[model samples]
Target: MAARWLKVLAAAPLMLSALTAAQPAQALVPYVAVPAERNLEGAGLGIAQAAARLLRIGQADDAARLAALTVQLIPDDPRGWVLLAEAQLRSNQNEEAAVSLAKARELDPKNAGILFAQGSLALKDSRPSEAADLIREGLKLDGNNAGAYFDLGNAYILMGKSGDALGAFERASKLRSDFWEAINNQALVLYEQNKAGEAIKRWRRVVGIKDAAEPNLALAAALNVAQPGNTESLQRAAKALAEDPNYVLESWQKEQLWGPRLRSAAAQLLAQPALKADVERAQANAGASDDLGDG
Candidate 1:
């Protein structure tokens, strides 16, 4: 009995080890860490700045694509929508620009700049009446906007309200003394109204202010009409044509919103035998037909 008990004690340690080895191990729970929060608005602003830079560099299509992404990232920001609208406008996607502007308006209804932008788009879409109304409303909110006044003048001109258009142009020039475009339009309206002397005076002032093609050509045409076969006028016309050959094309003139009176005057001036060579060269440069028709 004593010998059997000793053998069992010796085997006990091996049995205990086998039992420990046979037991199943417990599974460990995973430790999950949460991600850091993102500053989405700041990211959107950075993207918008990049888009604006692209636009400035004349990469309008790329600017528009990036602006679209920016709006998606910050849908609540009206500025983002406005930037997107500007990019879309530059890309010639007028309908998409309108939608983006509408969203901006919904977000910030009282913004005068947004209203002015909408008015400008209305003018581009050929809705002059709506454009005038929108611009007028914008002026009420921000009365000192010279560019808005200039646009309002254009709207009035399209609606055949010459007197109102003149007033608007004058207001624009008064608000911003160096606004040559508004002054030029004033001359345009004056010429249309048969005030050749006044138109010539305004055109002369515009040329003095800025040596641009539109005012230069306009003054040349007026001078030719007021004093036929004037050598100075012919010389000025030649120089203006060289500066911007597009003035030689009637379609281009109309696109610049040249009134019928101004266009007729330009046609007569261009028909001068002394201007034949200059007109031909200008036409060639503009890639237009040799015959300058009064369209």
Candidate 2:
């Protein structure tokens, strides 16, 4: 059956053209080489694999085009629709991605991944309540997804449920021990909740796990607040700013979901006269990047 469909699929374009050019009366006659259902599904899966490869290679536009074709070939296949939705998301076609995800959910209502994807879209759309609910539902179906829990924590943070957000981040970090981002978020919530020492401890641990800019700067801020004019904190703050100047900008920190309390601490750390040169350089770098983006 698969072999027969492969042959038919290979000749499909020619057959379609021939049928189009046929006489009206002949065209109306029934044709009998219909593809078997299983064969079509196999073909769709094959195409989906190709699309996945394209997506992995950074050819998001091509991947989306192929995934669109896959869904047309197997409209009932939830996997095809999910692939289409992912490609659409990569291309930043959020509305179309949402529609594709909805179609996939209709095809496979029990698919936890689809629910998680929808929840992520909702979070991007700033509907935190809806995002939380959808993510919770997905977790109910499959609770082991560390990334899903991380997203749930972000949603809870947006909803101002700091305690819930902390728990969610803790769960994510526990599920994946090397999940520094989740651990870092737990610090954000902790600091917002007035647990400064705990937040500082987590931030230090995050820096140990990964010498990334966010945790480094956050730790610096916490230390500067706890111990004024600390040399190590000032040095780390300078290094972090040099590494990723965007963290110097309040807007960027807010985008990273840094709570008000943390942001205030960072502002104080950045305002230090001892690190005047570092702050100026970071600000200049950030401004240049902003200008380049505008251009």
Candidate 3:
């Protein structure tokens, strides 16, 4: 169910603010559309390559299947094993992912990507110390990997090192400006550090940059807290609910991502009468594509 939600989130269109030319303060909305091409079928190329392409296009289930097949097809290739682990991880097949990662480790003990993956799995398992050490070693091998830096940020956050996490997130954003996930986490770290003003600024930048549920909601909630009962802020919150209603409808608490502080903000914003009514309306009218209920 979580995997399905990820696919929906990945494919959804940018739902930016409906702005007029006169609103000079409003930032221009960035639009992004993922290409819809499901043509790869493990043809001519190796199964790992095929799986990688599928995974890039938000087809994790299909990618996992292909990756599983790849291990059987090319048992000696550590790349196949690593690909399988990645696909399984995406599909939320944690145990299978572990098995695949272990096999890849046996084949190539120093593989940076595998080490990074293992680090992520360790983080997921709540072993932040181990995760941090593994990722640091992985970074020594591949210092240029933005994704690894992002994962390292997650480890730092779990370890309650907000300052370190912020640095990691900043490095990730420097490496890839379009890495909104890292930017979002930076906002989270800021919030965790009690830097509400700075966090709100980062959240607003993310809302202006893209129209994802998490960022939009963060901006809405922070704006509400900054200026309670403000009509414009309420409207923005309404707009976010209109963009993706199910987060409120299902009362989906993504504490793993948002943490207690942000979740409390979201709850506070949701409790607002005007925004609550607006969200309930959006929930009634929204289709499946606009929903992310509970998962």
| Global lDDT of each candidate | 0.86, 0.89, 0.76
- The TM-scores, one per candidate, come to 0.84, 0.86, 0.72
Ranking by lDDT: 2, 1, 3
Compute the lDDT of residue 215 as modeled in candidate 3: 80
**Top model by TM-score, which number?**
2
- Residue 118 local lDDT, model 2: 99
Model 1 scores a C-alpha lDDT of: 0.86
Name model 3 segments beyond 4 Å from true: 1-66, 249-256, 281-295
Q: On residues 3-112, what C-alpha lDDT tens digit does candidate 3 reach at each position?
A: 75445334322211132134444344356222222212232135567678889988888888867766754566788888888889888899999999989999998889
lDDT of 2 by residue, 208-242 (tens): 89999999999999999989779988999999999
User: Residue 20 CA error for candidate 2 (Å)?
Assistant: 9.0
Model 3 is weakest, by summed lDDT over 10 consecutive residues, at 11-20
lDDT of 1 by residue, 1-295 (tens): 3354345345534533543464444422234222122455665677788789888987788778778877866789999999999999988899999999999999999999999999999999999999999999999999999999999999999999999999999999999999999999999999999999999899889988998889988888988888977987898898999988999989988877899989988999999999999999998888443234312
The list of candidate 1 runs beyond 4 A from truth reads 1-38, 287-295
Clashes of each: 0, 0, 0
